[model samples]
Target: MKNKPTIAIVAHDAGGLGGMEIHLNEMIMRLKEDYHVTVVASSLQVTDSEGVTFIKIPVIKRPVPIRLILFAIFASIRLLFVKRDILHTTGAIVFNRADFSTVHFCHSGYLKATGGSRVSSGGSFFRKLNSGLASFIARTMERIVYRPGRTKRLLAVSNRVREEVLADFPYMPEQVGYLPNGVDIHKFKSIDDETKKKLRKQYGIPEEGHFLLFMGGDWPRKGLDLVIEAFNQAAERFPDLYLLVVGKGEREMYQKMVSPSFRERVLFTGKQSEPHHWFGMSDIFVFPSSYETFSLVVHEAAAAGMIVISTKVGGVEDLIANQVNGFILNRDRGEIAAALIDILSDVERYRVFGERARARVEQLTWENMHRILIRHYEENDQRLGQKALS
Candidate 1:
């Protein structure tokens, strides 16, 4: 029998920790069954990788410029020495080192949309210095990683990301492939009304309150401020409204964004391992993120039979059929409150929308995502074998 094709997956982090890290872990776990899997990451804290070989490379934690440059150098050097049929990397300026590279966040697109320069006109000296230094490293890395003939193959997290990568690298329009992030439909299953009632009671949630959900790690980027503002505006119209925010963002910081009248109703569960429970209890899933390559949470919520009210950013339009499954703000902040009011005021409409939302995501399970990924890995394996014979 032919030996299984060797595959190496490189990510900055490992395990089912954080958002992207969890997906990376899942990919490794899924692929290990078909191939000899190895993972090179800066930090790995999970033990679920039984069949996978792991290589740890040291890099200083976040916001440190020297750390990434050192990581890129070390990761490139290591790949050159390792023998593998396919090399998958999360991000870095490793160029041809990684055969398949996943673009989770398009740094160049972000810079282009926000601004080329990171220095603020009236910012403090330290803030300006940090921003300027980080910007320089990021933009430089983007150019190197996305340069023509540098990347062997590019996979985007969303269609919007595919467009952004192609926009940055003009020749890659046809080459870029995108598959939206997948949710485990089984894991995020909807509970019956009785079960939801039990969960609400366990979490000290009022049965009378309409639960609005927000799940994300970054508060600023996820538009949590706007969530608070919109929730406040709708609070008067939709009585007994409660917002349950799950993830890393500080509850204290976000509470300031909420109005005094409804501040106590906002609850933060912090970061959670199984956020699916929260999704099952939510009346609506609201994400007004400023940008996203794709949001796994949005689909998770949908799978739990929850209606989504999100800003039309990134690949949200790919999932939500406005007024059918959910409402899309389409980048208009003003529409957030209006959308919330419409869904809250009409119970039948809300129920129908939630059902459609659930139906829309029923087909996009993690198993399907793994199948697509396996095809990509096998194609690379075949190409590598052919090259060896030649």
Candidate 2:
């Protein structure tokens, strides 16, 4: 252990159960064999994880800007004495003093999508004021972290993300490494009829209906509204169709969007803890998100042997084989509805697609992801050492 490389993973919520945090913890677990790992988080819940040192930085968590700035300062200060050969951060906002960072999503790309860009900032006075200020700070921080001669490596989770980062800051293309996200193939297992029936009963999804699933955090950004619109349009033709959305967003907003006759057919599970069970119970997964670095749930759906219908966003192409495994489309309501109709229209096609989806995802595992990450860990550390000596 003493002879092994010391790696420090710094994130705002390393111990949290969100997808990024969970993957971070899993990465820590996997690297423990050849490295001494430590996690620096804002708040941490101690678990039976052997060989991990959790450093919690006390910080308030209301109003995200304050939390980000405070955590960045605290974590930066704390890193001064964190004896480690390499430091990995989940986000660029915090602890810019790092060897490498996992570029999950580019802030500049998100700002462009959300209309928070410097040139085209729009909204009410207060909204614009807040947005402008936040954007300025974030962009400034990003520029500093990604400046030329900085020598910090960037690990992009997907090609789309790498492109996004390079689009924002054109010079860092060579410094960026392409790394994709992975799912636990074993956890996203297909279930039998009995298991599906039990899950449907537990979630109040009618056991007899053909289920359409959508899972994401934000309704607008994740294109939950788009899914609802498509479902509403298609529900009229297929009475057995049921749309089950498991996400964190305005349920009432979407509920009211659905007509009185179709409201009952739409069910919002309100952020499920066990997504595998939801995926197992689902027939088809549909998500038309506006922008994504790499949608992890899409991989989970394919791994669970469900036919996926997503938009042409981010690294979807890496996971989907177009007409073979899943249907990747633009954000057209008619096109989305038509794709759903085609899948439901043909039983044989649906089965083949699901089978192909499962088979395609079989190669995507956490072990593979871990191996790639660890390789980069050593590469980045060695590169930094060479630069220091030069």
Alpha-carbon local distance difference test for all models:
0.76, 0.78
- Candidate 1 C-alpha lDDT tens digits along 217-285: 767668887888888999877768899998885667678888898877889888877688899887888
The residue-by-residue lDDT of candidate 2 on 154-256, one tens digit each, is 8888888787787877455678897777788899978887889988898766888789999977676677777878888888888999988887776776788
Per-prediction RMSD in angstroms? Answer: 3.1, 3.8
- For model 2, give the RMSD to the true fold: 3.8
The local lDDT score (0 to 100) that residue 166 gets in candidate 1 is: 86
Q: Per-residue error at 166 for model 2, in Å?
A: 2.3
- Residue-level lDDT for 381 in candidate 2: 57
Clashing pairs in 2: none
Count clashes in each candidate, considering only residues at least 3 apart in sequence or on different chains.
0, 0
- Please tell me which predicted candidate would have the highest lDDT against the true structure: 2
